[model samples]
Target chain A: SQQGEEDPQALSIQEGENATMNCSYKTSINNLQWYRQNSGRGLVHLILIRSNEREKHSGRLRVTLDTSKKSSSLLITASRAADTASYFCASGNKAAGNKLTFGGGTRVLVKP
Target chain B: GAGVSQSPSNKVTEKGKDVELRCDPISGHTALYWYRQSLGQGLEFLIYFQGNSAPDKSGLPSDRFSAERTGGSVSTLTIQRTQQEDSAVYLCASSLVASGSLNTGELFFGEGSRLTVL
Candidate 1:
């Protein structure tokens, strides 16, 4: 089974609206990271939240992690059409030799 | 290097043929990873190499899939007797020791190699 899974496989929103996606994992992790992919090419790292940290913020992006629930959420505020992309969550742990296990991803479409 | 580089941006091969994909990680990066992404699907782990340590091959799907890193820099992923199911975008990434407390778990990726098996 995949170690990480994302909820709300697809989402649609207009510019200026907020978008949120959640991720769940089955194992303990040292850190959880989020990435965005455009047009199915390379991925761009977005944010990283340590397992010990509950929330993190970077500009308009907010991420929250709940270890007890083994879940995490990414919130995009005032989303623009440029924000449209596939977002993926990855779980990293020492047991995996520092390699990350990625989720299927959530496809987000921000309409102008 | 400016970033991770993948060769053969696109490849097409018939069933039972063999193909090889190449990846050159950012200079000095110790960690390199390979992932496969099928259409409308998430990235699937394939392999990982860190410096001189033995690569972690747990994510490889079958015996026909193999990868080797030379001099801890460039890597090659080979698939023998390719099948249609092997068709996907093969992505390569590199990072600086992504695990430890001091390291941030960020991966820099290269434009993937699109592989098609017919």
Candidate 2:
């Protein structure tokens, strides 16, 4: 598993259900961020959780980071069909010149 | 444009040919970056630019790949002797500031330019 790599590459859930995705990294990070991409489009920023923070939320989305475990997770509550897209996690580490490295991403399919 | 704009949305070229992709970042944004995504692959960082000068290009795959930003606004990514392996969606993003304590995680991205090398 590479740094900023997410598991459950593909997921399917019925509308109104909650969905969760996981990401793990090898190195210490200054912050972790989530992103969403519609088909054939550029990514859109979703949320950011700093190393010092354990959990953060934005509307229907929630993000948690555990530095001790070198992992992070993204949760989407009350998922709708519009939530179908690819989700990626990115790691930002100061030791690495503060550039972001993106993960492979999870392909989410929210069925109506 | 109200958002980041990219030119030549799609380009198809023969192998060994040179190609240029352009990106116009949002107005008043001072930081820009270039990234590429191969099919089924994650976004790969190509370079980072602050103002008109690039400070980090270690992610560029080879010498054949080069990028330059001018006037602190528009940027051009040039690929020399393009190869089939270079086929990908080239994406450009901009932020209000460079990566640091004050940096926000949000990045405004342009619809990527899809490049196909035959």
Candidate 3:
């Protein structure tokens, strides 16, 4: 069964706009990581936020984790056309052999 | 000078025929993983290898799917009697370790092998 589910299956915005995507999981996790995929290719690791950390940032990406809510959100500020891709949140649980359970993902389109 | 690599980048095979996909993890990476992504969907875990420990093959969908990692470096996923449903992008990722710590969750991915079982 899939542990994580992402919201807003698709999003469209102009360049320089901000985009927000949400993910919700059913079980506890040691950490959650986000990844980006271009054109259905391999996924690239974006950022990882531990259960102890409420928020994290890298480049123009900001991620927030709320254990109590079992949800996380990824925000892309000043989005560029290059940022257009599918974003996924993968949850890592201790009982799951440290394997990542990925969400269906959110596809973002940035119009230049 | 290196990252995880997979080949062939694309493959097409007839139904009932077997196919093999290869993955080469980055040197010194202790953990390797195989995942399958169907059209417009999230990745489905297939198998995992961590060092010399027994591989975790719980994610394989059926007995038709099998994988082996030789020398703890290159791994191969073989599907016998392929079905059209098996057509998907097979992705390989490797990480430095298997612990779920904040720093260990980063996974380096390969370009993936696209399998089309017709």
Candidate 4:
């Protein structure tokens, strides 16, 4: 079964604008990781935030995790056309042997 | 291979035919995983292999789907009597660790094999 759901199933914005996608999961997670896919190709690992971590940033990407609310959010600042892709959040806990359970994903479109 | 490599970047076969997809994970990686993604849909976990043993095969959709990893290296996923619904991109990924913590929460993924069952 899928573990999480990304909100705003789809998002569209002009270049240079910011894009934010939210994800919510059910069970407690030891860590959460984000991924990006372009043109139905292989997924690229983006950033990971552990349960104890509240927020993490890599490049223009910022991920915030709130274990109390069982949710996380991905914020992309200075969106570019190249940033258009599907974003997914995967949850991994020790009980699951680090096997990830992924979410529905949020599709973002950056129009130039 | 420097990264996970999957064979037959694309495949098309008749409905009743069986298809085999191969995945060669990065050298020395202890974990390998397979996932299926329908058009515009989320990834559906198919199977996971740690070393040569699959502690979790629960994600496989049906009896038609089966996979095996040999010598802790290459893995193959076979689908028998392929159905149109089986058409999707099959992705293979690998990580350095089997369980516990990941130094870098990263999984190297192959370009994936696009399978179309006509």
Q: Model 2: clashing residue pairs?
A: none
The TM-score values for the models, in the order shown, are 0.97, 0.95, 0.97, 0.96
Order of candidate numbers by DockQ, starting with the best: 3, 1, 4, 2
Compared with the real two-chain complex, what DockQ does model 2 have?
0.60
- Model 4 lDDT per residue over B3-90, tens place: 8999899999999999999999999998899999999999898888887564589899999999999888899999999999999999
Q: Each candidate: how many clashes?
A: 0, 0, 0, 0
Q: Model 3 off-target regions past 4 Å?
A: none
What TM-score should be assigned to candidate 3? Answer: 0.97
Q: Model 3, A1-112: lDDT tens per residue?
A: 4788999999999999999999999998989999999995789999989889999999999999999999999999999999999999999887878888899999999999
Candidate 1 residue runs with Cα over 4 Å from true position: B100-102
Tens-digit lDDT string for candidate 1 (B1-107): 89999999999999999999999999988899999999999999999998888899999999999999999899999999999999999999999876533368589
**Each model's DockQ?**
0.68, 0.60, 0.71, 0.61
Across A1-112, the per-residue lDDT of candidate 2 in tens digits comes to 5568998899999999999999999898888889999999989999988888999999999999999999999999999999999999988777877677789999999999
lDDT of 4 at A103: 90
TM-score of the B chain in each candidate versus the native B chain: 0.96, 0.93, 0.96, 0.93
**Better-scoring candidate (lDDT), 1 or 4:** 1
1 or 2, greater by DockQ: 1
Question: lDDT of each structure?
Answer: 0.93, 0.89, 0.93, 0.90
Residues A1-112 of candidate 4 have per-residue lDDT tens digits of 4688999899999999999999998888888999999986899999988888999999999999999999999999999999999999988776877788789899999999
Q: How do these models rank on lDDT, best leading?
A: 1, 3, 4, 2
Off by over 4 Å in 4: B99-103
Chain A TM-score for each of the predictions: 0.97, 0.98, 0.97, 0.96
